[model samples]
Target chain A: MAPSDSDAIFSALADPTRRAILSLIGEHEELTAGEIAAHFDSLGRTAVSSHLRILRLAGLVAERRDGRFRHYSVTPTPADAVVAFLTSVYQNSLEQLASAVQGAATSEDTPAGRVEERSA
Target chain B: MGELILNNELRLEACPSELFALFGQGDAAVGWLFGSEAPLLRPGSLVRLALPLGGLARSPGTARVLSCQPNRRIDLMHETPWAGRVVCRFDPLDSGGTRLRVRVTIDDVEVARLGAELGLLGGYETGWWEVPLGLLISLSGPAGILGRSTANCAQLAVEEINADGGVMGRAVRLVVGDDATDPGVGAIAMRRLCRTPGLAAVIGMHSSATYAVTAPMAVAKGIPYLYTPTSEPTAEHPLLVRFGETPMDQLHRALPLMAAQTGGSRWFLAGNDYSWPRAVGATARAVIERMDGHVAGEGYLPLGSQNFEPLLAAIQRSGVDHVVSSFVGQDHVGFQRDFAASGLRDSIRTFAPLMDDAVVEHLGESGEGTWNALGYFVALDTSENREFLRRYSDRFGSCSPPVSAAAEGVYEAIHTWARSCRAGGGVEPTALLSGLRRSRFNGPRRCTLGGSLESLLLGEATRSGVRVLDELPAATQAS
Candidate 1:
């Protein structure tokens, strides 16, 4: 995935209300906008609709229409993309650390050969 | 915008109560989750878990239970590497299974930084002898301005030691805990550091307020703790070694020169209301009296005080030509900026013992002409110091925060501890302690453990950085 797409997912995940909305939708197979709005006491339907719109734009949620009603469900693809990005970043960091240590070990002034000589 | 919360739920075959019992089983639950061993989870218990990073390395995570309810909920707050809260909820399902909900609320920025630290730990090669050292410094809060440079310095020292075949032929690894500049937080960080497996020593660079709380904890755990900042003299303990100068060590050498240079015998004492500052104020009063100088005024503001108008007004009214201010970190920066803006910069010469390159840079133009005395200055023209700076810049980039006395102090503290380990021929606590008493380093600053500093350098801050004015004589001979 592109960095911007992952950024969009993170930006979408940054909001508490949107996260709650995503969690609510994720709990069941699917939920209409009204059903998700019912879980939050302070949030109105309009606010819920706006949050769902943002989640949709971020590709975190998918909306389907059937018989004049809309159902919302989480798009696992985006969440998996986030996990993949984090995993790859972690792996890259490890590789960098390993190579840096190896570089230090190979330096001429204090080489691993010298260490072996001293130990002998 | 407040915090990012991630919620995950899993349906297990066991019942709610039965599943809850597994959490209290300690190693079983830890092994199940992190594939590591852990102590029993209880309220206020420190939980140290080795979180594996892609089978390459294990990142140690320390969390404390805020509250735990039997078979229902367990809430935890993560301390090190990142800051976050976790809540586990157990609910009974209709089909007799349990729906376990885990909600983690964290700051995204911390998660990104955690990835970097995990990468550093990932380079650990299996079967290599490793000496884990704890570095408890303020990565956040008021003293956070000095955090990056201090951390960088510690990292540089560890790398240098590794490049030189490590301590006692064992590679050194640093485990960091952020004190956040709060005593309570420092206690948590100290507990986490003490609990780390194979932890050899702890090097602290936070405020003395935090030191008072953490020092006893380190002593109780029998770990060698080397505190690396200016502080008041405490009762000497074998395991606890202080590398920085004391209030008397700084003021005795600095006050006379400052008095002679400025030709002012009347002085005003200002500092944060803490043990170190109070000790500095007391020492300044005595030294001034001994020299037949009068302490024209004195005041102690609480830490993190930004408004220095009242203090400035008092300093002006007291008719003192020189002031000895001991405010630390951001408080130091704020006080200096306010003093300069008050137009008092023309008449009053300020002597702050705690000021360093980082704080001077933070002051920028306002730091001009301010006098400071410390054991190490960035402007020291010595081969040892130049090499130290070169290594630091090479590792952390030249754009990194300047190495100040506080930063250099920790760098020297690590090398000194490594020397002690070499002297004792092991990394055991008693061995390290005995070795520390006789440890000497010919680094940027010449230091002997449990002895007076070889010399204290007086510096005057300029727009670029602090310029070394003169090397004052050592206050006391090496014992």
Candidate 2:
């Protein structure tokens, strides 16, 4: 199965550019790429457009066609997905910490493949 | 590939076929383990025996005895205290040597869930002793642990340990090197790890890196080389613990059980071109032929070989029902993908002993519904495992663990290695190695003195070395 919509949303959020788009939408409700581009001092119009595209794919933004141009808007999703993804990512870090104490418990032993000749 | 029939005993340069003949169902395993003729046994590949009478017992009065020549690669199958089965194998190489493989198919999903639910993550590490060993051998000098799946798995392990609190306040670090699966790189990785600071200890090896380069570096560094995953006789290495089970451990149980379960004897072997498959094939062929099964086809592909159409065609033409695949690393996902895509997905049922979590994770949905044999399954029905799975999923994303000793071994060994570091206080290399040697944990398998947990820890510790755990003879076990 593909990543959950929430997971996709969280993964999408990992990028700074994507986050910037969301921030822009938050500050000035439902803006198109041209309007969002003016807010960034260094980003090009194309860059802004690409960022919006990613946000839209992640379901963080909604889009509607307006002739040659499409308008972008942030669509709300269930908050629990965000919470769950964050919890999981953070929990792995915690598990790493919990592992410290467990690591002190003892020492143990543990621990292959084929030949396919090909160039990718 | 040369053999001579001497006094009715087939003597081969390497017992490619011997791997199969050694494993039998029921009393066969019980008999070999006890050094007696397996007692009168009934049909059915699995026979539950009393724990006291059994070699590795998680609880009392019960142990699942597995039997099958599922593939030439798989050589052992046995029960963990957790009531799970783990299968180990040896894949013959096209060039030379063997690739050791281990897998635990979760038969009792409840047991796995329970173990996960109980919060004792150790259950997931049962029978991991073979993992590192097999992996190190695989690196035989191809690619080091870094950049490869081994590196990825190691990184994941290290990340988990650090994220979990550095194993008792000490950073749970790994002195890793590029086995690049190449000997030179393996040596380089070993030397680097040996010199690495703040790392508790080092295990596993590179190709051509040999025990000489790795063993001494670890020993000289005084870092604990908890386990070496090679099938070569391990009793010689004092600094390096040997968790590499002989042919009788998990395979003895797995082979016959697979044979009986599938009720087919003909075999078709597929593997990468390397030492692991070579060694494994030599031993396996002997075992299967003894059971009156013919090796319908045997073929070897270059390591990372992309095309399996020839092998698949042979399998189809040979009219073989069972396909024993001895593939590893990236090839694992590739071969399995091909297996599923092949028309044989429905016609031929594949049973592999080398499928581990890292490999299966790559396979993804492609792996579901395949009739693969396992020594442990992530879905086993164990209170402890259930909790571990839930936690692991919640923590590490939803990637399910491949059932077998190694994944669980990695799971437990992280804890064991951490505990060793904690015990040593400062957690130095050799100090940690020594600490690991002296300690035995009650691991998730529930065996006393942590013998079984020891099995898993040893597997993890040996991760950096040759994959000897894959060739475990049916005689050895980690219950």
Candidate 3:
């Protein structure tokens, strides 16, 4: 099943091992499965492959097969999408908050639109 | 002490305006800084800094905006507990990145001390700022001694771009591949680089023979490829652009002078069997005949052929006063050493259109009196060239490879590509081509390209080093 964009990005970024793999791929153009696996000496190739499969499914990483090796590279479009989504969220929420504050009636000399200070 | 000041600068992979907008504009500034609602910053707008107390008493302060210069500077004057003037200056970097500087001068030291006592600065960690990651760019060339010099310069160009803020506010990452001066290897490297996702463009192919095979392949793949060091400037492929001086350009600029210096009408030709050398030889022959010089002998050596004894003997017997050579890379070094050992330089002064610093360094005393033509030289006395040499030497140091025209071509290619990338606003082939056509820069040795791939300045390599002499007129270059 194809995961949703936010779910996929969060899932892909959830694992420390996957994040490390993504960082390694980011530093290079593309890293073969064997080359990527070589970085984790203690882990078996199959274990690393499973993690790569998860990342590929999440759309955070793209894979190209050549001969016996499958090369993986980070697709930054998803990260860009995440940034756009966050920016939109911030913009909309702030706009709504600003209008709500402006629409309210004034109270006390401190001004009603201004945030009230709570003394400790 | 008077007013204690704190200053910090960060190189961020973002445009100055974009960074300033995030910090000084409406909503975005508040969201970025405090993750809460804040009013639009006007000259006298009051901002409430609601310090999030970490298991301590909160100290809320009212800070008044002193000034707001869009994409430039924003100054804030605090009135309550932590009284200080927080000045944020945003400067655009050359690499399309932003250099954001923040300076805080505490006028009321006691207030700052009280805020510190309340664990506002230490616990909240508001003193530290963040810088985003740099973007990535890739390069390919002959990997070893043959290509490393060009690769080094390509890397240097990227560094300068990144320092300036990178292309379009993104940091540049250099992806390098070794062509090994072989066509087959170059093909594989090109394929590997093509498969690389987010690759902006490809630059650097040192050998014409390698380029001849790889250019068509890269064209077929629709990659925006900039041909550097290889002098065959056929713009047949839509996606391929030539940045190096063509053999015709070099020969036309330097041949007449070389013929005059030799004071003879008889000449011989020798070069590696390749598209560039063959083109150069043809152009030389035409130019020499035009100057009333006749070709006495000509020989084409297959690459990796060390035995130049027969060829040298033929030139020696032909009574040719000038020997025009087109040998490239390590082969050129080997041939020059052999030519010097054969006692050819004693009688026949050689004219090589492509000989560079690496060849000269390898030839040492042998290359002493030889003549060469190129677009750039490390020994150029101009301020721009001197600055280039200074940066290169400062970065790579004394033991670094000798700077050559080919290497400088690689450097120029990257800068041109970056500029075009900026102008075109993207790295797509058509965008880059359009941008490349519009790119211009004042390069080393007063060399500049306004539009298209024509280099206005050309130079001759002497015993002292490359001396800028002839520059083809714009009309002649256009023709």
Candidate 4:
């Protein structure tokens, strides 16, 4: 709902490596941080850790201790912040469009020549 | 390639003996290459070719020749698709089918390339389209001989497509199976789907059990199993195609909607005790887990159980907020009736993606207000479904399919297999599977199958080669 949470989620997704991380999770089901870091093209473990940390902080992922390894899962459809934003934006636009179209149609004072049913 | 040509291009590997079948028709150099019914040469005309090995290649295209000498010269000609003219002049031996000096001058390069790849010389076109057709033809009969004749939609589609020139001018031969919904029998049925000579892809398997067992066969053998059932997730192998539905693809869309609707993070799962149930259950578990929901309880039972008193009691106990039931066949009927009678209907509603017309219609009042994972609902508001229902009711005495089971998928599989066979450059399973994967068809449902091996999942492929609706159309489906 706030600007800060949006920045956090978008910033976490900003890196190309993070995008690649999302795809890896999709393909392999779930992966530990170490296992995910293993898929990178020569990126060191520390760098991967920061990326994972960013994802964790943004609530995009949740970590569980698997023995010595900390495995992560994409916080299933993450509805806390980012999903809420996208949902509200699209929902509001749809609502506004409906009102605008309804307003135009019922306005009898408008010229008949200008009045036309727009393909929604 | 369309359904027409694909049906005729049979499986080359299963029946190895097809390579040496003797249909006792005289060799027309051209006639022997193609089948005898080719419109290339005149009747009783003699076309000869110089041999690669030795002697003169003498051949008559469907001619009634009187006498012939040994090893030096011979005569016969029949119009065939293999070549314009075929001359097989044999130096007469003692007995049996002669090993003649066969020389074939084929006019088409594409035809020659296809022939060379399959290692077949001039055996494609021949006969009165019925004589030789009845020879090895005794092997696999024309479509609808599995004899139920309950659904000849695939055959009708094949014939129609063939009449319109076929996928590359080959005739598709659709095959019928008695899957009986057993896994092992389904596997065997799938084998016949691929290995039977001249069949393109197998547009068969109405049971998820059959498709699951057969999915491996299609993948290992490189035969495209065009699942038209619309509910099995058969996209695990490149050769496995779903012209139907997989629950995961559906749930990815439906659960999101349901979650948004109920705002509940808890759900329940139930299905008949079979391969489909377990696999789909596991998938649902995974999906719910992914969607941030907890599975409250799941119920599994063999197909024939009539008593649902305890399962109903369990759901009540679990306090599960949402439920999904994956039951097929008469079980759907029994469950609906029992569910209606259970008095738990108000408290425990379910979403079943596929329930047949037979069960739903039979249920009458009981079927009201229930949601099924439906590609084609009896009351579907779409024009396509309305027309299909009308035609089906007029033809088979039902507005909707007896059950959506694999009926349409089977119908689509037939067409898909036929089409794949036609488009397959050569009559090989690998090519046919690839061809079928690349196809998308508009049928009773919007059906498409991908060639990617991961798409060959048996548990979730649908008939008509489309992704089975995995979930209700709310959260994930693009409106």
Candidate 5:
């Protein structure tokens, strides 16, 4: 997934109801829309389904068709993508700092690289 | 200890797959790393790496592929003489490129040090110790009580390192050189130390004058030198690392508290006529002036001036209630004894930045009511200090020299050097120097150089013993 896709996943995760619904789906292999709504008494079926739609759009969940019902299951790709994106963001800053230091060092006398070459 | 993690990242104009292919194939990673004609990189497979420091180490070391996630992460655990682990990760960058991060950790101390020497690896923490390599390090200080106490701390550090299996799986032998508190002899000892074969680095805790001569000499010879207990602000040097509180660090945090408690704006500055004393006096004067306080008198005595009677009389005539003295060694002890005997002890409030537990103990009843503020004290009751004291006493006994901040500075320096050696992947001068720049960890007294300046812990001495007054916040480089 592209790094920009993290924005969509983050937006979907921003809502507490969506996060809780995602956690419930992750706990069970798959949950029907009716079964998910039953767990959250405060949230109506339309509200729960709306949250599921956002999660589905973010690629955080996969919807499977049963005989006459639809079941949602958590997808691992979005989470992995987020991890990769965050790691890259952190890595980029460190690299920039290292480059800045290296540039400053080079402006001065480049000390002799005293390391010996590897023998085959 | 957990495995050391060193992370380096680069943004390249390529996708994750494109970057992963560079390492996924045997041929691409050949010259860059593994160097074998047909280097296999599958998970659970064995791979051989061409050692960078070939003359100083074995040629090709073997490693096992711990795990591999295509287009993301690859972990390799080396099984060579110096065992270690390396992990490379790739991710997509916002600028339509790939960000590659590399982390290397050596399980074996010797190999880790060597690995750190040859690559872009920076400093890191170490997990365990296994000493198959023997690294000889030299320690120099005065042979007097203060210097001996510093040397004892170095010995304690050596024992601690050996107990952990030494750096890079190599046992360390600490060679002690006596400077005898003389700059001429100290320079000679340092020159000899710089010439010693197989010498990894040198840690010294002598006077600032000794450091002035010896530090430059060590740098000139391309030897790494870590100096402790000298407050003379040093000029930038490639091979020298100083571990001491600058006058600004001590006075800025300590003086205001001292002035507030004693409720005196009038101050007297008396110290030995040396570069360190001169610098400290200047710092104290600046801090006092900034606090809207006035200097009542300034006294400069020769380094070995035993007669404080004249100085005491001069201060009494000046009617200064507060004294800021920077005498070192026996001169400090002498001043304390004489000042106490003069009956001025009851009226005048004295503050000495260099006074430590040993000086306090030597002063006995005479040093009572004297106040000292510094980065470390033997009386600090932190868990790390407690563990250090427990270990130090166990090794050296209760009769051992009192562990001053100067001694603790040396102890911390050794551990810092060891970690830098490991981070640089080897003990080569250039690698060690680079690694030392990036090194960071907590030790006894929590002594550390967070940046260019060593972080200081401020404390004051009470009539009964030393009590920690405050901890100075960490400073950045040059701040």
Candidate 6:
């Protein structure tokens, strides 16, 4: 994934309100703007509406429009992409760890070190 | 490997409802399970698990809450890199407390793969490909009290670097070793770190005694070693970069200001008998003499000396109105407590060059009215400092140890090295050396690496923590 896209997703997920909104929408199939706003007493309808817009822009939420109201639901794509990116970064780190230990084992030429490395 | 199930049970002193309330309180209560500053927990919320291997390497896996049943249980399903389930059950015990059972079920193959990948069980070999940095800091002995917060700051830097795409598109991993605050142990740790494959650089936050031994090893191994605590200025080496405050950096402006406030100039110098403290005494004498101040007494004791009666008696007899103490760690705390207990604190004020948040925290009420000058303080009010503290608290939880100059120096040192690597186009020793010579980073302190002068702040310790008093003028030259 492009760095910018990943950054956008992360930035969107960084906010607590947006994360709560995502979780709320994910708990059900879909929720109208009014329904989501009702869950947050401190946030007004317009404030919740703007949060949904930002989440939609980051591709974290999908919007569906009926005659008079719009419904929002969590999009699995961005979450999946975030997990994939994190997984790759971690795997790369582990690969580096393996190489470091192996390099140390090769340099020492000690049977005990090699045996411990294998067992570890 | 097909499947693996790990089960653990613990009986806690809290009731089931009390135990359940902890999870909902915030990250500070549950940071051991979830990474710090995790999103609010409810069904369907995404939670990031803390990294494995004590956070030495990053392997963050995201999980989705499958169900949360009030005080009874909470279930989560791992969503990436592997398929897994974590079930946490709280059972109210008849005996009084709560019995908590946690069962984690995952694919056995994935577990083995992760272990092998972390090099716990070595199987695959590839050429050195990632930027591996070494952190050699004191984790035991006199200076060990500051170890956890210092290491946390370094880890925060690495995570932030990775979040920002890492150094030159390569992920950075930290390899930590304990120096035990002894030069001999430091030398061994330095040698081991220097021997790591493709080690980019090493950052040391231990004493100058350790640096005297470890810096040479890093230089010999062709690795750039950034020393991140106050130390005596040594002859420049290409591979050695000193990023902390020098004695002159702390004394030049602070001495005159402190003298003006106290209305007298009879000064007593005290510190642990080490190279750094000796250098501090020399610089304090020079600065005090330039201002026509009188040096009434001076003393040096071995590190970790708990009995300060002799020192307190000497201070009382010397009739000094101001003291410049260079003691560190437990000695710093012990001396201050004894100074206050001796009732001398009411008469003579202390100016400590090596004072920091951790030391001040340990000093508690005895720390009040003491003065400190450093490159960074936890109370420093700046946008960069606020953001730095926010990220720090987010990563380590708000209740973690406050940031000290030593810890902040580690954070800045790592970022400075990363910036230099970017400027030099690679992590080669010579290129990085040249880049470091001109590297400047905007952190809590706007620092210019290898520069003679740096921005220093004067702070007075209060009951809570150090409060920034004023910005001291930069010294004319390195002492």
Task: Name the DockQ score for candidate 5.
Answer: 0.01
Q: Clashing pairs in model 6?
A: A120-B120, A120-B121
Q: What is each candidate's DockQ, to 2 decimals?
A: 0.01, 0.01, 0.03, 0.01, 0.01, 0.01
Q: Tens digit of lDDT per residue, candidate 6, span A78-105?
A: 4244342233333323223333223212
Model 4 spans > 4 angstroms off: A1-120, B1-150, B166-170, B188-195, B218-222, B230-235, B259-265, B289-292, B356-358, B378-405, B419-427, B430-434, B447-479
lDDT string for model 1 (B391-445, tens) is 8878865435678899899998898889888887889988887776787777899
Score chain A of each prediction against the true chain A by TM-score and list the results: 0.66, 0.64, 0.62, 0.61, 0.65, 0.66
Q: Which consecutive 10 residues in model 6 chain B have the weakest lDDT in total?
A: B117-126
Let me know the TM-score candidate 3 reaches against the reference structure: 0.55
Docking class of 1: incorrect
Expressed as tens digits, the lDDT of each residue in B107-226 for candidate 3 is: 423323222221111111111121111111111111133343565687798899889887777777665544435454444445545555566677755577667666776777777677
lDDT of 6 by residue, B78-126 (tens): 5333346767788887866666666666564445433322112222222
**With candidate 3 superimposed using the best TM-score fit, by how many Å does residue B309's alpha carbon deviate from the native?**
0.3
Greater lDDT among 3 and 6 belongs to 6
Candidate 1 residue runs with Cα over 4 Å from true position: A1-120, B1-128, B449-452
Model 3 lDDT at residue B137: 16
Worst 10 residues of 4 chain B by lDDT: B131-140
Residue-wise C-alpha lDDT for candidate 1, range A1-120, written one tens digit per residue: 454665565556545356446645644568898887776557788998988898888777899999978998867564344443343322232223223223212224422211110010
User: How displaced is residue B353 in candidate 1, in Å?
Assistant: 0.8
* Interface RMSD, model 2, angstroms: 24.9
Residues B1-479, model 5: lDDT tens digits: 33433344455566678656655233422232323221345664545333322222213334457778888887775433234456777777776666666665533333333222211112222222322111112221111435445656777887887788777777777655545454644554454455446667777777787787777777777777777674867787777777777778777756777789888788889888878888989989998999999888888886546679889898888777688888876578778789889988788888887877766655666777666655578877778888888988798654355677778777877888877877787766787777877786477555444224444556555554566666674333225
| RMSD, candidate 4, Å | 30.1
Best by TM-score: 1
